[model samples]
Each structure stands twice: as structure tokens, then as C-alpha cells.
Target: MRMGFTGMTLDRADHLRRDEQALKLARMHPSARFLLLDGLKPVLAPDADRLLWVRRSQAPDNPSIFLGLDEEGIPHFALAGAAADVGGIATDARAAGTRLSAPEAGIVALARSLLDWHDRHGFCAACGAPTRPVKGGYGRQCDRCTAQHFPRVDPVVIMLAEKDGLALVGRQPGFPAGFFSALAGFVEPGESLEEAVARELWEEAGVRARSVRYVASQPWPFPSSLMIGALATADSHALSPDFEELEEARWVSREECAAALRGDGDWSAPPPLAIAHWLLRAWVEGQVPPS
Candidate 1:
């Protein structure tokens, strides 16, 4: 499957070394440079502003976090505090019609997730004491118990189920009218990717699936989630959507999916930036099973 526009490919050849060196450098220099992220968007420090400064309340440890580098090898940093608010910044960016490149979007997602994690994990669960930033903001150290905490990325399973000549699609309650995509859910603690796919399919659409195969994965940093894509086989053609989870569900034909992709149908497919769009495209192109 093809990656979405916002997908990022950063060459972190020297990042590991840089992260190790930054700590010693930060302690020596009291006023060190920091990057600011308004959600997943980076706050660029140009000529006038050499260092990004954000409100202390937003990101208390702004100077300490490690914002990953871009494809151009520029290190981006997360601005703590109100700068982490995504919806507000996204609306502003949209209103200004500030078009973002794929790499820029990826940076924004990364920044937002990193800062959010720090905000929520100010105290250690092991000792209930204040924690300090460590490892270029990748980890935290508990003052009371010496417990270490690391940033977490939740895994989500998104799959396209097919059998015969029809593919399964479903619409969640909050989706735009007539919008339907592949079924997806978070992976439980003990479940493998395939098990998660099978479980989600049966729970949401009442379909039993077999031959679950892994596809491409995407870093969906809506608070840090890794989208695991897969293709599954459904043994039945029945439409039994669990209304509690989905507003509607059906078995759509490959031609119908193709029409939706082409914007020639009553229902439209997801935007190109979403993994769902790629999954459907792969199915329509016969890269996956026809159904």
C-alpha cells in the first residue's frame, strides 16, 4: 500500500549521537535553544527569533524535549504548554490557508504527541513524585523512587476485509454523512495484530475473517498511535453492523469502491492522506484480493 501525503521518512543517521550530546551541552549552557510545536506544527525560529519560546504553563520543560528532525535534517523541538493544543492551531492554520507539506504535517504530529505525553506524565506512577526530563525528552526520571518512564505509542489495527467480489466497509457515528471506511480499533494487551483484526471485524461488523495478512503501517500521531494495516478474508457476505459502533455497514463491490475513489459515486472515499484511502485503493487496483 502507498503511504499518505503526511507520511515522513527522516534519516536519523546522526540523531542518536546528537541526542546523547545534547544533554551535556544543555547543562553547560544555561540558555539553550529549543523548538516549539503548536500541535504537530513546528514553530520555526528564523532570523528574528533564534530560539522558540512558549508559555511555561503549556510546556514546562520546553527546553528539554527532543523534537525529531525533518527530512532536511533540521531538528524540530516541541513547545510545552498551550502550544500543544492541536484543534485550535489547526483551525488557525486552515483559516489562514497556510498549506503544509507532508513533512511539515508529520513534524506537527510528532511534536504534539511528545509534548502531550510529557504533560500527562509529570508524576511517576511508581512513586507519585515529580519527574524530570531525560534522554532529550524521550524519557522521565522519578525523583522519589528513581523509576523511569518512556513515551508510548498505542497501536491500532485497520483492516480491509474481502470475500468473493465485495469488500467490507463501515461508517462510525461521527463520520460525515455517507462516509465509510475499513474497520479499525486499538489492539488489546495480549492480542497479536491478526487477532486484533479478527476480533474487531467480528465485534463491529459481525463478520468472521480468515487469512489475515499484514500490509503497511502509518504513524498516526493523534496523541501517538501507530496504525497497523492488514488485509483479511471474510467468509460471508451478510451485513450485520453493530449499530452501537457503526452507523452503517455493507459489502461494497470493487467497482463501487473505485467509483468512490474517482468521486463518481454517491459516497466518497477518505482523503489521500489517510491510510483508509490507500487500503481501498489497493483493493480496487487488485493488489489485494478482489473482494
Candidate 2:
């Protein structure tokens, strides 16, 4: 039951990563696998369905990110920047899920997040000095002021609020028509996950959640976010969506949600790769409390 990007079995031994020579050895591993990103898009094999993992000799001089080692101690790496016309293969990161294996999907997510982090955080915030990758891509070090920085991961609360036999779903204004998903919002400063879930439900759909429970988490790498999946029991079953953020918000029955997840219903739920779809599936399958 591993989610798309949750089962990355690689050992990211960050504590033991000070040896730069070890990183060099990993890069030069005879059996090392490498993936390249042209900007944020992954370069794919021309005639294959998966990422084109090139050899050490074939990889670019500098990879934008370093993915840690697998169980076999074989290292994985990624090059970010522009898609090189390497062996006539290329594909956008968004399409990686459809063609790549689940583990590779996790690797792609890591690469994408690191790419966005490096792109946005080229300068240190503490002293506004230029920073370079250090500790095998685990973080950045500013040459001036000697400030160290780690990558940023934004926490987002995504929830399914249910009452009676129905769960609430909301559609953003710009989503494909009829498409709806669990209510989600970025956690504001100084808010707990439960508080964020409650606040988002209230702000977006005017639903007051009396209680909420954690479900799971997923790495949403479209510019780097960690989706905290949750389930909430509403204080009342009511609907008054804030039009600014939602085109429509309403309670959908369990049967309807079940069909939506299966792609058989007219309503469009989030895709299978998204955590929202799993949240909806959990609700329709009676995993929520008060059963």
C-alpha cells in the first residue's frame, strides 16, 4: 500500500556524509545509475517507457541533485538544468509516473523538489550571499557568513470531511469542469496539522470539523509540498463555499465517491497518483471512524 513517493528505500545517511571523497566514489561507481533533468523535465529513453538512467561516463559533469544509495549500495544521481539531447530521449517530469516504476517515481519527485529548491534558493537568506550545494546535495553552504541552509518543504493539509454517508469535495475555479478533490490549503505559520485541516475546511467550504484524524502523507513535488492526508468529522453538514477559492463545494455520497475513484462516474476526482484520490478512496471504503 505504498503511495507513489513514500517508499524510497534508499538510505540517506546524512549524518555520515561529510566525506566529499565518498561522494566522488559514489559518482564513479561502476554500476551507478543516473537520471538527467532538462530544467525540471526528466530525460527519457527514446524508445523506452522509463527514465533513461545513463552511465557515469554518459552523465553530465555535474548533477543538480544526489539521490542516496539503494540497498545494494548502488548510488543514484540526477542532473538538473536543461534537457540535453542525449541519445534522443526526453520527457516531462509530470509524465514520469505513467511510464516509470513506483520507485523511480519517488526518485523523480526527489529530483524535481531539489531542482526547484536550488533554483529558488541560490542565495542565502541569513546574509543574502551566494550558496553552493554541499553534503552531497543534502544542503547548501554560503561562502560568506558561513551560513548553512537546508531545502524547504512546505506542509499542506489535505482532508476529507465526512458527515452522514457522504464526504465533502471541492473544486477550484480553474480545474477541469466537474473535477473535485479533498479540501487542501497550506498550513499557515504556528498552526498544528489538525488546526490547519480545521481552518481550511472552514475557510474553503464553511464546514466546521469537530475532530480530525491523520491518514497518511505524500510528497507532492510540483514545486515541493508535503501533503498531510487527514479525515475529519464535520460538526454539521452544511455548504457555503467561498467563491474566491472554490467554484463549487458540496457533499458527495459514499457511493458517488467510490465511482469517482474508479473513474466510472461523471464527476472527476484527483488522479490515482495524487493523495486526494487516496483520501477519497479511504472514505468511500469506510475507513473513517463512526463506522
Candidate 3:
């Protein structure tokens, strides 16, 4: 199954990111395009199905991040400040997925992640000194100690623990009413992906995972994370839900999950934009453990 934010079609020219002369020439290229953002929202073309790209001359005079080149060697950039009120409609990233093609959604993910990283990492973690953007916004350099830093993508383990053809699902306290999805947690330091999945299942739902298998992955750029999807065989069916981490935890059959995804049930599945939805769909269709 296709996941959101995974089909970027750009040729990320790493060779030009540090070459000032080459980057300058790229910026001046006649085919260069600029993607304008209203704050963090992406501005869509009038048709509202694609990103509204503007010539550099028509773009806002704000700091920009090089997003790489398309097939024709046209350089693409993204910027976030003082976008002109005219031209296109600005849509939240979460909602953009339904309206954009997979490749366009991928571009939004990369652009937003890079721009947000630059905004949040303007200082060196080691020296407490100001850091400047380097490598076309792919990294930063410390002003004081000359240390190099790169963007960080945190890993998150989202999984389903199956026993007797039923999958365990849970909803956090903050989740909307009647909404449940796959159990997930951040991958703690020094832990393997399989280890994290097992730990999260045990910690959140008091379920023991016997064996773990990779399912698929999706790029989740809310801030930035790699959602590692997996399926685990459960040792037993009993559950001891940890109320602190989950509002409720229970087992759902594949039919029940399919109904929720189809909007024919009392509960609503996670939206299509989320990896959780795809994971549930995969389980419902017996695509768990993948092919």
C-alpha cells in the first residue's frame, strides 16, 4: 500500500549544497521555482491539487531552503515568511495529503521538515553558540567552535500485536472520542526496533510480544519522525491497560477494523494520512508481516 510522504521525485544534488558558486548558478537558473509557505502552511495552486510554485522574482524576500531539482534540472526552493496574500490557498499539512498527489505530499514533507529543523536548531548543541545553515539547509555549522550538525529524524515504533487473529489497539487519553489506532512509542536510545516494539506493547497494554516482523515504514514529518511499522505475535490475549498511557485498550477482529475504516461502525479509524490507518488496513487485509 502507498503511504503518505514517501514518493518524493527530486534529485537532491548533494554536490551543490556546499559549492557556493554552483549553488549561485542554480539560484540564477531561469527554470528555478520557489514554493511559498504561509507560516508553516503550504500554499496550493488555485486548482488546489498541486503546490503553487512561483518564479524567484515573484516569491517572498525571506530565507529559503533548497528542496532539490526536478527532472528538468530546475532548482526548487521553499520559504516561509511574508508570502503574498494572493496566488493560492494555504492548507494545513495534515489536510494537504488528501488533496495532493503522493509526490507533492512528499515535497511538502521534506520542505516542512527542513524548514522546521532550521527554525528549531539555530544554535549549537555542544557549544551554545549560534549556528548557520549549511549544505543547503541540510545541516548547520557552529559559529564559535565550527562544529557541524545535521537534521535529526526521530524513530517511532507503531505496531500491532496479534493473537488468535485479533489485533490489539489503543487510544491515548488525548485522542478524540471513539478513535483508536495502533500502539506506538518513541524508540528509546540504544534499543533495537524490535525491542522497542516489544517494550511498548508490554508497557502500554501489558501484552507480551513473542516475535516481531517488519511491515512497512512511513515518513511522518510533524516536526520529523520515521514511523517504523511492524507486527508482533502475542503470547496471550489478556490485557492490563496502563491508564496513564492509554485511555483504553482492547482487541479488535479484522472485520471490526475493516468496518471502522469503512466508516460503517461506531468508532472511526485513524485518517488515511496516518501510518496507523495503513497499518490497520494491512492487518485487515492480511498484509501483516508483509510479503
TM-score of each: 0.80, 0.94, 0.96
Given candidate 2, what's the lDDT at residue 231? 93
| lDDT score of residue 187 within candidate 3 | 100
Candidate order by TM-score, decreasing, is 3, 2, 1
Which portions of model 1 miss their true places by more than 4 Å? Answer: 5-21, 24-35, 39-61, 68-74, 81-98, 289-291
For residues 1-291, could you state the per-residue lDDT of candidate 1 as single tens digits?
A: 235424445433345434667644533343433445554444533332122343333344435465544455444345543333422232222211124455555555566677778878999989789998777777888978889999899999999889887889989999998888989999999899989999999999999998998777777756788888899999898767889999998889988999999888878788766788888888888776432
Give the TM-score (vs. native) of candidate 1. 0.80
Local accuracy of candidate 2 as per-residue lDDT tens digits, 108-161: 888888877888888999999899988878789999999999988999999988
Clashing pairs in 3: none
Model 2, runs deviating above 4 Å = 81-84, 289-291
The TM-score leader among the candidates is 3
Residue 194 displacement (Å), model 3: 0.5
Candidate 3 wrong stretches, greater than 4 Å: none
The per-prediction CA RMSD against the true structure, in angstroms, equals: 5.2, 1.8, 1.5
- After TM-score superposition, the amount by which residue 95's alpha carbon in candidate 3 deviates from its true location, in angstroms, is 0.6
